[model samples]
Target: MPRSEYVASIRSRIGTDLLLLPGVTAVIRDEDRFLLARHQHSGLWSLIGGAVEPGEEPGEAVIREVFEETAANVRVRRIVGVYGGHPMMVTYPNGDQVGYVTTAYDCELLSPATPDLDELLEVGWFERDEIKTLPRRTWIDRVIDDVPRGSV
Candidate 1:
């Protein structure tokens, strides 16, 4: 399920027009490392996450996305931040535009396995020092910055 049926329907009408969407991101941690996945299209590494489905809570969405993208079961320990606004907006290669109001969570990883879905090219655990050097977007960096300050 690359894009949800609901989002697909909306995109059919709006094309590349920006959609204000709810999303969730997980900063999964084990010991001193955090989990990140390479986006299939962008090839940039970022935290595991995806759009929040209709009727799904942010916490539920992160858990689902973690398993869907990493084949890992995780429990949400706490929320790191609620980020939105223009800075978090994204334009996909296929001309799908979305401004995501994302709830980023600090999650406890239960397992490490290859993704069950095809959205990610690879997955790995990275220390904070290494995460700062990755070719990721500002939104992802913001999420990572909050991990040490403790989830708020």
Candidate 2:
């Protein structure tokens, strides 16, 4: 997906300099397994989530992000965690650097769906052991418990 208009406006002014932004993510869990998306750009398996649009609540953002990214309908169960810094910082292929303060939700999948392909390569559920083997963002340990670090 392209940068949100809100973000584009910021980039127009700052021009790829570091920007701290609010983001949301969903840890869509079904018992021991979790729903994750494989990003087309990074080739990393990550939680289903995205930035909080202007005037949107974090909860609403997570729900919207889940559906947009994976075509999955989800309900926010509760906030799982809030994180920032190293792992949350992103430098896009275009060199637009963003540091995200991400609000993560414990979400329940109302219905599973396919990945958008534009944003993701695949979307599916994986067990704890399986996830550890997949390439993942650094924040995986902060999101899921008792897992060894993942590839990438």
Best by TM-score: 2
Model 1 backbone overlap count: 0
Per-residue lDDT over 78-104 for candidate 1, one digit per residue giving the tens place of the 0 to 100 score:
888988987788888887788989999
lDDT string, candidate 2, 1-152, tens digits = 56899999998999989999999988877777888899987888898888999999999999999889878798777787788889898887888898999988888789867999899999888987788788889687687873223421
TM-scores, all models, native as reference: 0.91, 0.92
Evaluate residue 69 in candidate 2 and report its C-alpha lDDT on the 0 to 100 scale. Answer: 89
Please list the residue runs of candidate 1 whose C-alpha ends up more than 4 Å from where it truly belongs after superposition.
149-152
lDDT of each prediction vs. the true structure? 0.82, 0.84
Sequence-dependent TM-score of model 2: 0.92
Clashing pairs in 2: none
Error of model 2, residue 111, in angstroms: 1.1
Tally clashes: model 2. Answer: 0
